[model samples]
Target: MSADRGLWITLEGGDGTGKTTQAVLLAEWLRDGGREVLRTREPGGSEVGVLIRDIVLHHRGDVAPRAEALLYAADRAHHVATVVRPALERGDVVIQDRYLDSSVAYQGAGRILDPVEVRELSLWAAEGALPDLTVLLDLDPAEARCRLDSADKPFDRLEAEREEFHARVRDAFLGLAAAEPERFLVVDAAQDPESIASAVRERVAALLG
Candidate 1:
């Protein structure tokens, strides 16, 4: 939380919202501007996180919802300790693909758990570390599903959930953005990637200035 620390930016949304693409673009743009940037993703940001990601996202059998939430929290704990926090403390802009908000939406709303509790668990796990700005790529669940289908990638555990689950996740993200407008920039992800990236750059420029 030091003022001298670099910005921590997170891109969040349901599956197929193009968070990965945006994260890459943002990091590249920042680096081109001469900022030291570290682009990472949750549930697989660190060495330990890779193992956790497999268990959480691709485990063959069913995982208890609470257990799933705790697993994500565990990954967050390790990821912040070993990767994210150090980078920020060293004054490197960190463009992360997901964060506690994903847990709040995927586990809390999508899994029918208490969103506040989910957020609290993640915060405590990561010692209350929060992104300076979270870019939420908001897209309709139906359209998102269509995009996922077109991608032809094997569906992960969370991505394979029903439409209703995805709908709830989308709603949860919007609700979080509404609650903290200053910390979140909600963009229409259905736009062309170039347009979306341009919008993201504008917000990030303001932050950097």
Candidate 2:
């Protein structure tokens, strides 16, 4: 929000909670409202990010928790510096699919690392760039798994993790939102996509005001 930069909004949730769907919807809605919006996602938001994303999310074998965290931090560093920051500087609203919170939730909670440490690592890696608003789509892990099953796509490395892992991730997201009420809009993802998008639009509109 410094220097009157364009608003940076991020979508976050457990797997299959419709983050991608909502990110697209939010970006579309913002554009309809006459804003130039840049839609992107973590771990693959830049030319360098694609490789990092594959390793962290699609690699065939186990990645040590610390190593995995480092990969994400590396991607985030490149992404925020090259893609997100520049877009915001140009006065383009950025609707991002994930941010440091994901690392805190997934790598920290899900991977059993200290959430605070993971958060600090990500913040340091990205030079402390944070979103103006983070929309957290809260969902039950069982419901999220069902939704993923219905999608019928091969699960990514993280998505293929046990239900317990996802539950931890979900809880971490909620905890993060609770701690930063002003920066996070906690939405019930069980609702229909249209309804969820409407709620997001309303919150973002208020922010814009």
Candidate 3:
């Protein structure tokens, strides 16, 4: 809430947890309130990030855990420098789909890497930028899998991971929220879209004030 900067909000959760749906609703609501909102996501928020995203998410070949982590950090470094920071400096609300927390959860906990080292690498990559508010949409891995099956979309690398991996990711996200209560809003993704959006809006409204 610095005088020269607008808010930074991020939506985070496992696949099929409706982060996109809620991001859309939140962006629309912010726009309706006469705010300039920039909707973006990690690993594809910049042109460089798009290439990294394809390799990390779509390549059929195996990526070593440390290599994957480095790729994410590369994307984050370029993305924050070229895309996210400018929007915030211009006083635009940045509603991002994912951020460093995703790296910590997926690469660290899910992939059995050191979470602290992963976080440190991420912080170093983005020059220590953190979202002003992070909305974590929590859901069970089994239920999330069902939703993904119903969507009929091809599984990406991470989504194709075993349920146990996703469960670890979920627990990691919750732990992060618990550690940073003021910066995080943990929502039940099983709720209806409207209900979830309402909860998000309530939190965002308080921040805007």
Candidate 4:
């Protein structure tokens, strides 16, 4: 937001809550309203980031919480440097599907890692950049799992965890929104996709104003 270019908005939620779809819809709406929007997602938004994503999410082998957190932070560092920062400098409003909050939620609270430690690592990864607005699409864990029906494509390594884990992550997201009341907007993801999109569009428009 300080770059004299565009605002940075991020969409965050548990698995299958439709963050990607809503992000796309909001970006399209912003563009139609005559703004340049750069749409992207985390874990694999860049070259090295993609490999890092696979390592973090697909490696079924033993993985320590600290080490796993480091991998995620590494991918995010690349993603912000290569994709997010440059786009913002060019006057493009960046609508990132997921960002730093995911790390704090999934690795920190969901994995039972210390929040202070997670914050420290995130500070290193992100340097000074942060989102202007973070829209958290809240959803029930059972509902989220039902949405991800399949053997062909599995949930992310973090997302594939137990329901209690996701519930903790969701609570963490809510706490984050409460802690930073000005930045995060909590939205119910239980509604239909179209209705959710409409709600997001309305919130995003308000944020930009």
Compare the candidates by lDDT and give the number of the best one: 3
TM-score of each: 0.97, 0.97, 0.97, 0.92
lDDT (C-alpha, whole model) for all candidates? 0.93, 0.92, 0.94, 0.84
Model 4 poorest ten-residue lDDT run:
1-10
Candidate 2 per-residue C-alpha lDDT over 4-61 given as tens digits, one digit per residue, 9 for 90 to 100: 4599999999999999999889888887878888999998999899999989989898
lDDT of 4 at 83: 91
lDDT of 4 by residue, 1-209 (tens): 12246888999989888888888788778878888888887888888988887888888787899998998888888888889898888978998888888888988998889977887787788786889889899998888888886435766677678989999998988888899988888889998888888877776777666
Error (Å) of candidate 2 at residue 3 is 14
In model 2, residue pairs whose N, Cα or C atoms come closer than 3 Å (at least 3 residues apart or on different chains), thus clashing, are none
Q: What is the lDDT of candidate 3?
A: 0.94
Error of 1 at 96 (Å): 0.5
Tens digits of lDDT, candidate 3, 4-89: 45999999999999999999999999888888999999889999999999999999999999999999999999999998999998
Models sorted by lDDT, best on top: 3, 1, 2, 4
Model 2 residue 156 distance off true place after TM-score fit, in angstroms? 0.6
Could you tell me the C-alpha RMSD of candidate 1 in Å?
2.1
lDDT at position 208, candidate 1: 82
Against the true structure, candidate 1 reaches a TM-score of 0.97
Clashes of each: 0, 0, 0, 0
Clashes of 2: 0
